[model samples]
Structure formats: structure tokens, C-alpha cells
Target chain A: MATYTRKNAWNQNGTFSNSDLLWYAKGVRAMQARALNDQASWWFFAAIHNEYLSGQTTFPGWAYISAPPAVPTSPLPSQSIRDKFWNQCQHQSWYFEPWHRGYLIAIEAQIRAIVIGLGGPNDWSLPYWNYFGPGNQYKIPPAFTQLTLPDGSPNPLFVKARYGPRNNGDIYIPLPPVSQDCQRNTIYTGSNAVTPNPGYGGPSTGFSNAGSVSGNLENNPHNMVHTYIGGSITSTDYGLMSDPGTAALDPIFYLHHCNIDRMWASWNAAGNANPTSTNWLKGPAATGGRKFVMPMPSSRAGWVYTPNDMKSLSQLNYVYDNLSTGITKQLVGSLAQRLTKLGVNLIQTQPQPDENMDMGGNSEMVGANEGALTLKNSGARTAVRFQKEAWAKVPKSLMNASVTKVPDHVYLQLENVKGKMDSNVLAVSVNHKLAGHVSLFGLRKASSNDGHHGGAGLTFILDITNLVDELHLNNALDADSLDVTISPDNDIPNDEEITVGRVSLHRQPQS
Target chain B: MTAAERSRRSVSLLIFVLSATCWGLLLVKPAAVKHCFVTGGELSRTSLEILLLTNPISPMLAGWGLMVLAMMLPKLIIPIQYTCERSFKNRRFRAASLFVLGYMGVWMVVGALMIGGILGLTLFMPGSYTPAIVVGIIAAIWQFSPVKQQCLNRGHNHKALAAFGRAADYDSVLFGFEHAVWCVGSNWVLMLFPVLLPGGNNFVMLAVTLLMLSEHMEAPRTPRWRINLSSKLIRILFAQTSIRLARS
Candidate 1:
């Protein structure tokens, strides 16, 4: 998913966007429906899986082989068995929704490949799990119980297999198969539903990884919440994430990231798009770092995510399509032309148009004011500094007061930069969400191993005590928060050079 | 041949001649060049002239273009020589890996010394002398040491040279890996320069590169040295492994 708000951040929904996340969720859900509608689809496949594990099947040529050529319908369910299955499922929380959404996508893709054979509309497309990549910390959920169906009854294995030897060892508990069929009309405990993590996206949304957050929930972006809860997991294996020990192995890891991507998408939408508004996320910090900040994929302090060799979503061979779509309405009007005509001698005269037709730079934020823009430093980032050739306004008194409780502290309305210009600095203030936070990124000259001085310097991160201390908030300040735009330091070159960079808030206070 | 005679002749005849020949080809006379100022510090002509005079070898640092040294010299020449004696010398694990051991032993001491020199230069130097003089002294002094011989990959002082006129694949690989380790160790001093600077721009890159270069040393050695070989090369080809594992 793209950035949720104008600011590059995870949505409160805790989502990430990728074609895989969408396609996989849809695929998995579709597969689930396929499996449940005709139990033969899933159960038959599950049987083959069981046999393969138990050394029974000599040549299990296919994932499934439905008996009675015609798909079975109105299947008879054993009362006791169905009741037990329903009973077990009734207890589960829906927090697994977006999470399972990814696995189902992958599983569906796999099934499509196996049954339909690797191409066409049913072509298999799986999540690109960072199996051997960096930032590998996957925790397997306890939901996937490895149980065998003995004469159609769920039988328990590994009774003493690892029973008392590890983790208080209670041999066997009644194993319940992972099912999504009984969920209709089921009031899900929104608390645990795998929705967008508040840390990443806004409320009531699933794990979106919008890169912003508004709705408050525990590990809303459930996948990353694993890292938040469990210490960490390495890239273990694929399609085998199980137990807390083997989560990284699960093929679902990529899907989890995809959902997190979605949460981020939602967050992009959640941000206050108004050019003069402020969404109080948190205020300045008390040294160390920002009161709050999100972990960036490739940041120096947190897991920094940069555009990889094939990092752009466009480059990915796989693309995810959403089961649902958000409204992307386009405006049809000529307001600017009308405004020009309305200045009929009654208003002030407009300035002569500049010669350059391409006034916009690629890096410019789209909103009237940059909405919750997220800037980060990687590789031992310690501080953030900002400097510029122009004057930057401070936050209003009310907004400043809001910072007292850390309602919001983000930069806004940054001047666009283009080409390789000389040291044009922007203001910088490190948000305290991690260590080595930057308070300012003084002006910098970008040169390719030679003299090609350019705009905006990015200084090494250091402690962010000063910016937080000089708290400037702008509530009622409208969409464009005034205090956030780094004021150009007039004392220095004072010639078009500006620098702006800030460290994310220091690790969200342990919680 | 007497060891001293063989070593000296090898150094003078092969290494020196080859080195001079290679260096001779790369010498480019500096002409009109772009002047870049660091920190808006006035770059005076006097400063440039003085710096040029002092830093004679600095020009060769980048445009040295002697990449063949990294390959042909270290990789090919040593393999042909080390092979002849590997079998008899190995006579099967009787002696604990002389080539890799000796090569690595020299590598460690040299690496440490180089590292120490770098630390001293960066931490201790008062910036009293010109870079040319400093580098010249460094280059001159290095010429006499075992480190220079190994790093340059010349066969002089190469103990197994006569014995293994055409060494096997195993000996070559061991020597090659050892050479890689030493190469890293040898460059430690020079690599440290970029990292120690206190700024963010290019200085940070230099620091990171230094870190990566340093970490890269951890490869091809240590626990990897602990791998066991199959039956065939145990006694013959050397650290051919299983023998090392058995000893361990």
C-alpha cells in the first residue's frame, strides 16, 4: 500500500500494501470457501498432507482427488463432530482475520497452482516472504494445531512427544482445526481482530500498515505485533511457520507484511489532509528521543526499509488485488481558471507566471500541507537537524500547549526541492521512538564523489533534546502545521539552502 | 639454491621488475584539474603545490589500475608453485598445514601491525609531516618485511615454492583463502582512514564501508576452518579438512 497520510507512515490499522497482501487474502478466502463448501477440497488435501507426513502415500500426485466426480453438496455433518468443531471455533478471536487473510491468499495460490497448474487466471502467486532477508522476526501463532483425523475424529498426537519435557508439558489438548466458516454473524472481539495496528494505521481498520496510526489497539498490525510481543525470530523456513519457535518459517510472513501494508494504506487516508490541521499524535520528547515514533524498515535505529534492488511495488512479479476497493474520486472542475476570472479588478493583481512549467519536484508531498510526513535515519542514526534559507513559523500557543501532553509533533508544509542544488537546509527534530534520534539535519551538499554541491544536508543522528525543548505546536493551525516547517537559518549561506531531518521518537515506552 | 639467495633474487628479479613495469604503465602526468574545496576552506595554489609535492604516491591510489595484482599475481603464480610439494609435504597430515598456517600466521601479525599503525596514525599522528613523506616511508619500510612479500604475492620467501612446482587445487585454494584474509589484514590501516572522520556526508559512508570491510574478515576463516573434508584429500591436499577435524 502507498503511504497512508501525506506523511510516510503506517496507518493506525497496522497495514502494509503489496499485490500479494490483497491477492493472497482474496485467494486464501476463496480457497477457504472452496474447502468449506465442499469439505472434500480442503479435507482431501489435508488427508494427503497427513499421509505424506506419516509415510503412507507412495505417490500423492495431486493436492486433492475428489471422489464422486461431481462436487459433493449438502454434505452430511456428524452432529457430535460438528458441535465439537463449532465449540472450539467459538472461542477464537477475529484478530487473526487480516493475518489469516495472507495465509489463505498463499494457500489459495498454491492450490490454484497445484490443481489448475501454475498459470492462467488461477495462476499461483505467493507472498514473497523475507525468508533469508533482513528484518526476519516472525512468531508462529498457536492456532495451527498439528492434529490427525482418525476415522473422521480429531485425534491428538505428541502427547508426551514434547509434553512435560518443555513448557510445563501438558501432553494433549483437544486439537481444533483452523476454520473460518462459523464466523458469520459471530460478534468478533474487535479487541483482538487482526485489524490495522494503531501504531501503524487509524481505527476500525484491519492491519493496513498505512504507516500512521489513530485507532488504539494492541498489535493491530498483528504480524509486527509479534516482534512487539515475542523477542524476535530469524528467517527460519517458508510455509512452515508454527509455534513461537518456527514463525519465521511460515509462508504467511509475507502475507502478514502485505496486510500490514494495507493498514499503512488506510493510515495514509486517516492523516489530517487539511493544509492547516493537526492530529495530535504526540508532543516533543524528554531527551533520549521522541515521545512516540514508528519503526522504519531501513532506519539506522529500527529496521530500515529502503527501496531495494527490486523494492518498488511495480517491480514485483506478483501483485495483490483487493477483495474490496477504496473510493478514489476524481474532481471535475476548473476552479483555478474561475478564480483567475473572479479577480475582476476587485481583488489584488496576480503575479506574473514563472517560466518553468514543471514547478513540482518528485519528492514534494501531495497534500496542501505535508501530512504526518515520516523521515528517518538509518545505520546508527543518532540525531536530526534542520536548516533552511527561509523563515519558518512556530506552532500557535494552543498547539504548543497540546505538545505539553504530546498530542502532536510533526513537520508540515516543506518547500519542494528539485535537481542537485547547493546546501539548502530544512529544520530537523528527532521524534523519540528509538535510539540515536536526530533533532536536526543541517544543510548538505550532494555530490557524486566530486564537486556537485546540492540541496539539503542530512546530518548524522544525535540526541534530540533541543527540538523537543523548543516545542512548537500548531492546533487550529489548520491543515498546514506552522511550527514544523524547518526555518532556513538566515545566518548561514542564506542562499536557497535548507535541511530538514528528525529522529523518530525513542522506542514507544516499552509498551 | 640457498634460501637467502632464492628469496632475494625472487624479490629483485620477479617482484621488483614486475612491480616497476606495472607502475611505469600507470603514471599519468597531472594536468588542468577541477579544484574542490573542503569546508569552504580557501584552497590556495601554494597549498596545492605543497600537497602535490608531499603526496607523490597519492595519485597512484585511485588510478593505480593495477587490478591484475589482486588476481594474476596472488591467485595464479602461487598456485603453480605450491602444488609440487603438497603431496610429499602433506605425506598425509603429518605436519599441521604449513601453507595455510604459515600464510595465516604472517597474515595475523601483519594485519595486527597494520591495524596498530593505522590506529596510531589516526589517533596519534599530529599531522606534522606531509602525506607523501609519510606514505613513502611506509612504502619503503614495507618493502623489507615478510608482510610486503606475502601481500604482493611474489614467490620470494615462499617456503613451499621449490617443493610444489605445480601444486594441486587444494593447496591453491588454501593459499588463496589465506591470501584473502591477509589482504584484508594488510589493508586495515588504509581502510581506517575513511571511517575515523567525524562528519556525516561521505564520512559516514567511509565509516560504514570500514565496518563492512572489517566484518568481511569473519568469512572463510574461524569456524569455517573447522569444516571436515571427505576421504580423498584428508592426508594429501592439506587443510583438506577431515584431518583438521580429526586433530580437533
Candidate 2:
């Protein structure tokens, strides 16, 4: 077997009309023509990730103006197939990285097989949309923007419903899709049962379709790209990528996930480690005695996978063309220089993957708002009053080196954030400075209340550790309350209100 | 210890003390608080009506309240811990106290109604093991019912409460009350079955409490009629034990 290399789509053949993209389009169209029940069909492959309401002409949270295509009907696939394979995307869990990696490989194999039968090259690999790369990469590739290909055939890559920032047919992400923000995280897993904010990869969960407390990587870039390309905050007609149920249907969804997969590889190359815990390594079975299985192209038995099986890219027989980008190299280089200055040899003092990576520790809730806040499209501010007793025990400076040997990390959480739309990117600021943006990706599924989170809705925890330290330096931390303003990135109508159940503050004093 | 950890320990301790006390009370006075509506404790319609009219409600309620505290409080540690941790440190005790009050208040009202219903059943229908058997069947049916699962799933939801002032107190009470309603919806039939039993009420209570705790530990799944033994915790323990044995 030949090792497949996934290259950046922007740099492929130095143009958009590369052989890889062309063959991918052809393969997708061919697959789309097959029956929905066929495992190798485009719809089946997408449904394996997630599926929309079976017979509903109108989807949830969608207005009458945006009627979805007729949902495919078929004689029921085997109960075993449905249970083992369909709708098994692992979101908001530690398995988010590994589950998707296996999923991509399975689908990639199917696509590659079809492409080969179509007389395409043998070495064809899935190209990723690295919007984080240099140049005008922020825009949708010109291939997806055009209504027709060079031969005047309808472009399978082009999706007309994509209502980007302008709410027009333009399907481009105005903001940077992903950031190095996720790379800073060291812990691979955290449990939502203990704390509101879990880990970098996600909280440990059992057979979660959409669990609570999404991992850091899954939250940003992954979600941000999905929501940004699918629709704007104000658009009523959201594209397929906007909703998780319909996200996998879009041709671009695979490319977006490919980039997310590449991010995991890059994070590893930077010396960050995955969890070695048996609970994580064993997949859902270790937690709930359930296995993570997907339908194989050739067999009815399907393929069973565990996080342990996915730890090695080389073992998987595929690798990204470039794992360590310039940005990653720069961050890793700076850290190396810092270690050298501290009289520690970088190579000799290399930390284990799990070392000092446990961010999901016991955090004390020091403050919270009195009630839920209805976020406005313009902006809304709320005050989180500090618990005077707990606040008294807090160090003068949050930065450990400045005040105490053990640094206390502070976090601001938006608990039970319920909204009907996925495009409501709330830019959260503390004391009039940008702290972080809360991406409403997968909001429709997550906020269903009937879903994994129950009626608690969605909770977002932002590590405002450095921001708090800056406040302390400016003597602003002495205040009885901290001002939190949540402003939407796009202008939304007054009717569509995003209700944040409560805005609370937590402090984790390192033990 | 952190306030949240302390609160959790405190709640666990409270459940322990309450359970011990209930068990002690049961051992000392097994016949002290018999539900006369039980299978063999039959009475005529006039006698039952007279007993209902003349009997002091306070003592009977006090007994039921004790039973509720012991059997139900174990399931509440998670909610109480969250309530305490979410509250301001100075107001933690007050918040948790109000939450208990709100929680117990709902159970007391529901318990009174249940007692009245059992008395009514004794008056109208001939009291036998049949009524107990029927209620048990209903409870079992409810255990697999979608509506009950929905209630159980909703029971896992913990609302974000206000940290200070009257609003905080109100929110704490509301949160507790909401949780108790769902708790009652899911398990009231099961609780009623033990009460209506001819005998072995204490033993049944213990069994039902354990069952409730096991189910509560499970993550919310799609509400359906399928069997949900909620052996997630048991699976975890089993996994841990096997791993340890292997390592050893």
C-alpha cells in the first residue's frame, strides 16, 4: 500500500483547478448518483457522519424560505449497520480527534476506490482547506465559488445555499478559520462531570453523538469554519455546513475536517501528547462497554476503532504534506529559547505528553450573574459580582510567577447558552478588551435540550488567565464585579435572541 | 478542602446520617408508621373515612418526610454540590438550605397526596396484595416508559443559579423544586409500590433507593421504551477492577 499525503488545497498544483480537486468533484458526483442505501454512496457516507430529519421537508431552525432537498427514503438498512455505523460522529468528547480520523480514512478509502475506477491517478489524496495559510486563503477556493466548471457542467463543489458573511451566494470565510489558540492546550481529555470546561481534545465520554463540553480544537477552527462558510449570524437560510445533521452533505465539509485532522498531527509534532489513560485509549467501551464502529466498504461487519489505534499517523499509512507550518515552528522555537534561558536543555527536559497538561482541575466558582442574559446583535454587557469571601483568598496577580509559586487560572463561562442559529459568533470581552469569541457551531444540535446536554444547554468556558493578570497589573482586578460584554459578529434581528443561562467566573488555584 | 468539595462531602454525610437515622427508626419501631392501606391491614369504608378525618396529619407526614430524606437525598448530592459551589461562599449554606427546603417541600406535598390516594384506595377497593402487585407492575412499566426516561434525563439538568441576594435564594429554591418534580415524575410509582406493600416496606425502600441512584448516574440518552439498566457506573467499576487485577 502506498502512503497518501494530504496537501494544502491552496498550494496544490499552484492553482484551484488541480487534478486532486477535479477528481474529488468527479468522484463525489459519481457517488451521489448511487442509491442512498449503498455504503459507498455520497449520501450514505455523509449520513454515516450525521443525517437530517428523515421525511421532513423543513428542517429544524430553518425557515420556510430555506426548504431542504427531499430526504432520501430506502428500505431500512440492517439494524446492525444502523446501530454500528450510521450517525456516529464523536463531538464534544475525547474521541473527537480519533473518531473523525478513522471516519475520514474510511470515507477517503471509498472515494479513492471510486476515483481509481474512474481512471484517476493512484496517488490521489484528500486535499485540506488550510485557510490559516498565507495569501488570500481566507476566501473560498475559486473552484467552489464558480457555478459551473470549465466544461459548463454544474459544479458539484459549488453549493448555492452557502450564505457567507454577506448572506449572498458567496461562500467565503471572512475571518481566519482556525488559530494557534488550540495548540496552547496540553491536556487531551477532561470530564464535564467535574468542571464546566473540559480538556483540549474534549471530555471523556461514552458513545457520544454530541456530548457536552466540546474540546478546544473542536470548538474553534473546526466549528468556526463550519459556521462561517455555511451562513452569517443574520441569515435565516443556512447552508448544509451550518448544521451538524446536514454538514457532512457539503463537499467542502470533508476538506474542512481534513484541515481539523491535520491540526491534530501538527499539535503532536509540536510535542503535545494525547492521553495515555485506559479510559481514553479503549474508546467508548472503556466508559460504557460500547465500541466505536463504522461501516467498511467491502464488509458488512464494519470496522471497529479505538483511540489507541489512531495515535500513530504512520501506522494509519497517511500523513499531511506539511505537519509543522511556519506558525507552529515559530511558537515551538520561542518556547525552546525560553527553556534554554532557564538553564534547561530543551531536548533533555522534554515534558511527557500529559505533564502539566491537566487544566480540568477543581475550579472554584467565585462569581456569577444573578440571571440569564439575552445577547443583543449590537452588544450587551453584564456584571459578574465576585463572592467577597472567595475573592479575598485570590492572589493579587493571577500570573503564578508574579504573586505566588502556584498560578491560579481564571475562567469565564457562559453556561447553558441556547440559541436557534449557528452563526451567532458572540465576541466576549472583559473590561472592554477582547477575551475570546464563543462559536455557536453545532448550536442547533447542542441546544436541542433533548440532546446530550439535557436541558442544561451548552456551556462555553474561556481561559481568561492572562486577561485577569493584565487586569491585576492595571489595578482593575480590585473591582467587586467584572464587566462582560457579548457582542455578535454579525447584525441579527431582535427576534432571534441568544439566551446565555448565566455568565460565571471560576478560579483554579494550582495545587 | 474547596467549598464545592466540602459541600459535596457535607451532602454525602447528611445522606449517611439521614439513612442511618431512618434505618434506626425502622429497626426500633417497625410498626410505628404502618400505611394501614397496605395489603393485610384492611379496614371498612366507614372506619377508613373516620381514620382519615380524625388522624393527626403531622405525625404521619413527619414519618413520610424522614423516609423521603433517607431514600431520596442520596440522589441529590450532585445538585446540592452544584448549588453550593455556584453560590457565593458567604451564601453557600443559605443557598443549600433553601434548596433542601424547596426540594423537601415538593416531596411533602406529593407524599400527602399519595397518602390520601392510598387511603382512598383502601376505602373503595378491597385491600390485598393485588393492589401492591398492580402498583409494582405500573412502576415496572414506567421504568421502561419514554415519559419516565424523559423525566430522568431532565433530572440530570442543573440550572445556573444567581450567586447573591433574594434572586439567588429564589433561584436556588426554584432549581431544587424543578429537580424534585422530575425526580418524583420518574420514581413516584416505584416509591408508592413499597408504601402499598403488605410488608417488607423498609427492605423495598432500600432496593428502590439503590435502583434510583444507579439510573441517575447514567448520561442522558434518547427517551425511549427500551430497557435502561444504567450500568455505566458498574461497567466503570468492573473495568477498573479488571485492569487493576491484570496490573497486579
Candidate 3:
């Protein structure tokens, strides 16, 4: 009943509205303000949604809203220089830039329509919880949502996406495992006979090595939208008596998808601006985004989605309508808080929880490295012996891998190497491509030469995000996360095989 | 009358009035629609407004979009009172054209008011939905008002008009407003809900869609239902208004 009336109503310029619109209006603004804190992230989200919107209205997929990502083989740029790489990376060029652009613009329009349909913008700014950091680390303004729950309520989910009040109180709702039937829908199709990229990309022979990828997924030479993070929407409500995808049952999917679509669009926009640098397209999509199955020759030894394939945005019938800068803030604000927690703290100044950096800045749980980590003996000043074990927290850090987001993949680099030639600098790595599984995904290839004296200073890059991403559905997971192994060749003065001296993470500024 | 016939006439009149309004307003005077959308102003007589007047479809589509007013106008204004008044005179023949044109003109002008009102809402109101929806719903139900009935009916069959076109003018006026009222009653809720979609997902699009189709499906054959449905809507709207008023 709190709607405006003839005599006392408000216009955009005036303070009009029945009381509820004021509150409702506030929620919308808050959503926007929260997003604006980081415009780049939201732009990427918008691109993904836009691509889906466009494709959904056009080609229309069954069950899922978009058709799988397309993989084109005929367009290959063949050359003698490409032959150096292995065969598994044949069809890996689809998940690049301008393609992501189409998706970004389309979804922007969808959310805008929702905004206009609501009422319009009430002025608001994205707010960063002091719980994360004070400054640039958590400043994206536009990704905020209508305040879902009151602040300070303890979120009880495992692998916690929640951020605020020092982490204990806020966590995500523990997710149920994918139902037996749901897994059936994710049937993968990969090929072994055809080597994907003969020479252009990375190792084609060992793609599925040691649980690297879903064999069929990596082998599938198509499906671009599947990602390092999440899966694509498949069919819906199979239990319905009569199919109603056309009937528009559960229309709420559109709005939820608007968020998903927005994420993809934002990613696409970023991809457009920063196309992979060297050997970018020369390699296959590290993740099985564009194709159903990727060629994982290395992982054939243990576990891997050898032929990993992903879906394409064009297959989606819908696209995002490009929106004004003012509109994307709600989306940004929502994501910023989550990123603050998962991403490592990178503020260079005072290394503690400050308003300007991530919340965990100063905790002993996290350590810093000037570059190559330095190790000193417990009692000795000359730092002659490297310890068997060293550790620090790294929620934010560059994931090193032939392919990133391989769940729990951890790669250690030796920064601030201050020691004698024979003094050892040890590098360690852990790769857990799937959860609850052993570190079969972990690979340890030393830097070949550890120190100048060649006493054995090893440098290894590990990627285990895939394990984290998949197993994360289980509540038991925590910072107790590990797999990472040290090289057998490296000589740590002590009995422990691997020692991590320092850890650091990186993040962008909040413009 | 058959509901189908009424629907057909209703649709034709809606299209006719809309097309006529577009053709007429653009040819005669149409500064309202052009500048209204971009600058979000309709009544302003600025150079931007003048530019709009010169642009054809700018005002044409704008004018057409609002002729929804004319659909409900005929049912409320030209019907019961005006044409009956015209039927009694011998000069009713000449008066039919004048009256129909006048009646059509009145709705067209009203359309402009709405087009202008929408412009005003976007420009002046900024981001308020309550006012826009309230206005749309009110404009929708107001067609049933006795006063609106009198103005539309009387203007169509003034003493001079009544003296000119006898029975035909009587039918024309009666037929005219019936056209207008039906449209306003049917489209009001659907259009109004979009204004709410942004604020809350709870508005329930499916329920609202059904209500609108039900109203549109039975305009003449089930005048009772239309009246019943409209009365309920009118009451609900004002009931909402009163509560809001109390809160404010």
C-alpha cells in the first residue's frame, strides 16, 4: 500500500514515493553503489551475460540457455614455428577477446531494463566492509546486490565466501553435492585419436595426466564458455510433466542468469582489452572452455579431464545490452567483498589489515617476500642452511600452471634469494585438480639449477585451484589445504623435503 | 453486441485512433513526442522541442504510443450520453464528423498529455515508480467516471452537434468512448507492473498477465465482468493510495 498518490508523490528530482519505494529504492542503490567500487570486474560480468542474452534469443540451446562454445579448426594459422609444442592443444584459440565483447554489451541491456522497470536509480555508493581492507583492494562499487541479509549475521557455509567481522561469523551456506541425476547431464565428449594442437600450443601429449582434466572435456575441441571456475547451465526441471522451457516456467532463472551473464560479459571485456600476450593463442585454452574435451597428454598418467571442452557464448540466445557506467556498480559491489577474502593481500605499504588493503594484511598467518624468498638458519647469522619446511598464507597470488585454476594447484617461486652459492633455495608445489583426491595433480619440475653455486635451489609452480573449485562444495575444506611437494634433487639442510620461505599475492586498484 | 465484434471494433478504433493521431498530430503539431524521450520533456518549447516538432516519426511513434488513451476514451465519453443526445436532432449527419473528430481530437490531446506526462515523470521525477504507476492506473480508471463520461459525451453531441447528425452520431459517440475505456482498463495493470519489476520481483508477472488478458478478452459481451473487474481494480488502487497516504 505504500505507493505514491496524486497529491504527495516524488519524481526523480523530488523526494516522492510511498514509504516502501524509499526502502526499495535504497536497496537498489546499495546494490549499485556496491558494484561501482570496481568497474572492470563488472564490465567483464556484463560481457558474459550479454553474450548469453544475444545467443539465447537467436540459436537457443536445450536445457541450458546457450549452445556450447564453438571450436573452429579450419581457421588455424599453420607455421613451422608452431611445431615446437605438443599435440594436445590443437583447438585452443576460441576463448579470446572481441568474442567476449558481444556477450558484455548484450547483458548490460538486460539489467538496465530491470533497473528501469524497478523505478530508476536512487543515488548510492558501493560500500567496502572494513573487515576486508580499507582501500583499493575491495573498492569495486557496482557489483553489490540488494542487501541479501543483514550485516554481521554468521554465514554458515563451508569453504566460506563470506567476508566480515574477522571471518568466524560469516561463511557461505554449505552446498549439497551435485545430485546423482545432475551429474548425468554433464556427460563429456573427448577425442584421443586427433591431437588438438600438434605444435602451436603447450604439451598435447599429457593434458589429462594425473587427474588434470575430465578426459572427455579436454578432448572436446569445442565449448568456449566452460571455465576454470564454474560449469554452464544444462537442461532444467526434467521432472516437469510437459516441457516448459518455451513456457517460461521458473522465469527467475533469467534474473539469476543475469548475474551469471554479467560475470561472463565482464570477463569478455577484460579479455578484449588484454588479449593473451606471447604464445597466448599459440596455446589451447588451459581450461576446457571452448571445447568439450581438451588433450591432456601429461595427465594421461593419472587423473585428468583429458579432452576438456567448454561451451560458447554465441550459443546463448540472449545478449547483454551495453549499459552506462552508472549502471554497473551494483554488480561490482557484490563481488568485491568475496574477492577481498579469496585473493591475496597485495598492499605494499603497512603490511597489516588497513582500510586501504585486504583485511589480513598484518597477520602472521601471511608472510612477505622481496621477490625470491630468503631462508636463514634458526641460530646462525650467515644463513648457511635452508630449513626443511617454511610456510605462509597466500589467498592472493599469481597461480602458476601450464593451465590455471587447476583447483589446489600451488607453485612456489624463490624470491629474495640471499645466500652462498652452495646454500640451497628450495621450491615446492602442490596440484590437487580434484577435491578429496590425492595430490596426483601436483607436479614438481625443478628450476634445473637452484642457486649460482648449483647446490640445488629448486623453483616449482603448482596449480591446485581445480581441486579447490570442485572439492570446495564439501564443508570440511579449509586453509588446511595442501598437496605441494618439494623436488627430490633440492638439498634443504634439514630433513623436510620442501620448504616455502615466503608468499605474496597480487590485486588491481579500485578505480 | 458480440464480444468478438466489440473486440474487432475496439481493435480497429485503437489502430485507427492511434494511426490517425500519429498522422494528425505529426502533420498539425508534434513537438511533444520528439524531445520528450531523450531530454525527457514533452511540454517544453525549447529549440530541442522545436527540433522534435520537425522530426516526423519522432513525434509520430511517440504520439502513436499514447493513443491508448483514445481506446478507453470512446467507451467512457462518446457512448451513453453524447450520441444519445445527438440522435434526437435532424442535423446529426453533419455533426457526426465534427463530433467524431472532436472526440478523437480530445483523446489525441490526452495521449499527448500522457506522452508529456511520461516525459515529465522521467525528467522531473528522476527514479520514482509510485507516481508513474499511480498516474497510469488513475488515467485507466478515470475513463469510467461520470464526469469523463459527460465531457466526452457532451462534446460529441453538443446542441449544435445533436442538431446535425441524429442517430448515427449517437452511435458514433457511444462506440467511440467504449473503444477508449476498454484499452485503458486492459493495459493499465500490465504497463504499471513494469514500473514495479525494478523495485521488487514479487509483483508476479504471470498473475498480472492473466488479469490483463481476461479483461482484454471480454470487453462488450461481458460489460458486467469489465465493470466488475474495473471496480475491483479501482478500489484496489485507491485502497493502495489511502494506505500510502496514511503512512505518509
Candidate 1 TM-score to native: 0.25
Ranking by DockQ: 2, 1, 3
Quote the lDDT for A5 in model 2: 88
Score residue A363 of candidate 2 by CA lDDT.
64
Tens digits of per-residue lDDT for model 1, B1-248: 11212333343356436544543443323432111101111223334344434333333232222322311232222322323212232321222234434444444454444433433443333232333245535534543344533333222112111112233334444554555454543343343332233223134333333333222211111111111211221222232243346557
Order by TM-score, highest first? 2, 1, 3
Tens digits of lDDT, candidate 2, B103-181: 9899999989987877766666645677788898888899999898889888877887877788898998998899889
Q: Per-residue lDDT for A357-475 in model 1, tens only?
A: 11111111111221123322211122222211111212222132221111112222122122122211223333322211111111111211110111112222122222332333212
> For residues A375-492, what per-residue lDDT tens digits would candidate 3 score against the true structure?
3333111111111121212222222211112112222222212221111212233332321111110111111111111112221122233333333344323443343333321123
Q: Which candidate would rank higher by lDDT, 2 or 3?
A: 2
Tell me the deviation in Å of residue A2 in model 1. 23
In model 3 chain B, the worst 10-residue window by lDDT is B217-226
Instruction: Report the candidate with higher DockQ, 1 versus 3.
Output: 1
Instruction: Write model 2 residue lDDT over A1-511, tens digit each, in one string.
Output: 4379888777653244677788788877777777777777777777788665343355432223242323355644665566566777877778889989988888787788888999998878998887777787777767776666677887777765677755676766655434656765555664221122466687655322224567888888777778778775344556678777777877888988898899898888777678877777888777654577766667546788888999868678888888754443232343333224323344544542223334334667788877788877667789988887787555542323321123466889888787777765778899888888767877766665455556676778887866776676676777899999998876667667778888999887553
The candidate that wins on DockQ is 2
lDDT comparison, 1 vs 2, better candidate: 2
Interface RMSD of candidate 2, in Å, is 4.5
